[model samples]
Target: MNAREVNTLNIVGGRVIDPTTDADGRLVDIHVVDGRIAVIVEAGGALPSADSVLDASNAVVSPGFVDLHTHLREPGREESETIETGSRAAALGGFTAVVAMPNTDPAQDSRAVVEFVREQGRRAGLCEVVPSGCITVGRAGEQLVPYAELMKSGVTLFTDDGNGVQDPLLMRRAFEYSSDLGVTMAQHCEVSRLTAGAVMHEGSCCSHLGLPGWPSIAEELMVHRDIELVRITGGRLHVLHVSTARSVEMIRAAKADGLSVTAEVTPHHFTLDDESLRSFDPVFKVNPPLRTMADIEALKAGLRDGTIDAIATDHAPHADHLKEQPLDTAPPGMLGLETAFALSVGELGMDLRSVLACLSWNPARIAGIADRHGRPVAVGEPANLAVLDPGVGWTVDRRRLASKSRNTPYEGRSVTGRVRHTVLNGRAVVIDQVAQR
Candidate 1:
């Protein structure tokens, strides 16, 4: 399918809530031409004609979401998800951009892999798919990837997502190297030694179920290590999938101490708990496995208080054969992109603007794509926006999701707030909840 070339579009009668520009849910009409915002008029002000009009009544129009962590699983694992399929899922979920993790079959540690990912995204043309480079060569954690070369190829964030850099000296060197290159390093924050046989959080649920437990310290220890490393090297660090109360406290302290650290919490981390593992279902399984209810409260507080910088989906998708295995044998992950907004709005108790801050602008800044995505809704900014109905409720049905995988943990759950339209570079990739291509 060819990319939809939208020349002009007008989003009408929506409550514009651009936190970047402080629009604050004001009723306005936004006009776009040639892939850029042409004008933003008040609700009753005169409007310009356009090739297409999206009626956004009773909706909150804001910058399209930017996910800091998304596993596209392409370059090898096409049966699970390809760049095209993942970008389509992102658009339908109101995302304008997603950072593709570098844990593919061959691993995205080289310029060829990085360029291949970017070119595929350009061909998809649904959303901006930024490729994250692997911190270690082939994600082996033994040696670092070619940072300067990858950075030259436009890769900004680096991570060995499935595995954290375990060697302190190696990680410090990575920090030093990345600092010089002016790029950011993201850590998955798990100490493999402590989680060798773990399947879920080490808590009452795991004890009762006789399942191997993944202790919070496994993640917190790494978080602490990375914080100190960032403090020592003054290199920017992003902690991924923060799942413990202590982890949040440590991040808060790190920020107070002026360390260049940013952290993200997954929707599942803030919404679900280890008790979900009691069902013995694999859908509840995820890396940095869901923690206790106390951890959930802490994550929520961190988000509300600004300690947690963004709400990334970590949208890991696995085929049925892999995801449907017995709890101890199944891979850890869950479908998130499609239900992220609803889960945040219905579960976090945060206002719509605050939610967008985490889902949109903050994440865009973290992923280094703020220039185009997460831009203010004003003249001259790129027309990447999402029209969301904050009051509407919908039940999550796995069969209806855009991703090829059906491993959503929120299946059958009902939640308020849904994306009504998503405009990507002036093109209506999604209108009235339907994907355009």
Candidate 2:
């Protein structure tokens, strides 16, 4: 069941929705040859011969999804996830490419580490894995990594995820350096001082549960600081997993101010609230902890109004033993890649077009992979595509997921819009909701 390159594939009877080329839900047939889209014709138009044919009837075909933030956990925590398993999960979730975060055991600060991650993904043969370099050496938040060397290895995004750079001066200098290198700095907007001993959102929920609280101001402060830093250094900045109403407001204002900034919101931040903490489930314990329903409303508003450019799954995974501990002692994170698209469509209630913009094109632009992964499904384009049955419904089951981790927060919840098939490089990686390898 290994993913081998296919010479030709004929996808029939799907509604093509390529936002980049303004193809709005037109019934069409896509023909792929030699890992590229050979032609696209009307549904009932002239046909092309192929080695394989996929019936995409009643499905929506679009450019494959691109996740700007994904934690693959290779070269470190293989007990939780690896590049192969994560890529399987991603293909099933309709994602053809993911930006592997640099928070591994050895850390992806060196060109050697970044190349290892990329090569491992290639051997896995499931999806395109883009490695991000750590903004600071060893992710220590002090010395900057060899940005130019990492860039030579094809790393376009840098971040010290799981921890923001605490020193303002260091961050400003990093921004200045990255600006000159023409790379984007993605920030995990958290102030360690404010979030100390925090398990859930610093709100009535934490108070009622008698637990430590992570305040919204903690994330907002970093967002505001980074926005100002972007203004000063003239560097590209991307705020990751924005969780609060004020954070959304600040990003909206920053966008209006013409700052070179983009922001992302996770599905959990918009779909679930801190009230889920009443059960004291460690699955709900996430960094930049879940906020109130008011914050959810604001995040949705930001998505609708174009304040949030992408809906990235901060797809963190944890081993069952680690995640099963008490909420206060457990690590913060949850499985996301397998459920991101379904939750984004079912919970946000946005049109399919807007959802794809957040899930596909916008994130591709942010990761600088739009040239290959998120191109329009047209003649001569690379054949990375997802065929989605938007009318289908399914419930979350952690045991059925492709990731090695079983830490999904949406277990047993019903969701709309299942991925019928995923095609990567003219090869079907997932068919009929099943992973090929």
* Per-candidate count of clashing residue pairs (backbone under 3 Å): 0, 0
Candidate 2 residue pairs in clash (backbone atoms < 3 Å):
none
lDDT comparing candidate 1 with the true structure: 0.92
Per-residue CA lDDT of model 2 for 10-129, tens digit only, reads 999999887754536789998898889998899978878899888899999989999999999999999999999999999999999999999998999998899999999999888899
| Least well predicted 10-residue stretch by lDDT in candidate 1 | 17-26
**Candidate 2 weakest lDDT stretch, 10 residues:** 16-25
336-423: candidate 1 lDDT, tens digit per residue? 9999999998899998789999999999998988899888888999999999987899999999999989899998999988999999
Give candidate 2 misplaced runs (Cα > 4 Å). 1-6, 21-24
In terms of lDDT, the best-performing candidate is 1
TM-score of 1: 0.98
Q: Which pairs clash in model 1?
A: none
Candidate 2, TM-score vs. the true structure? 0.98
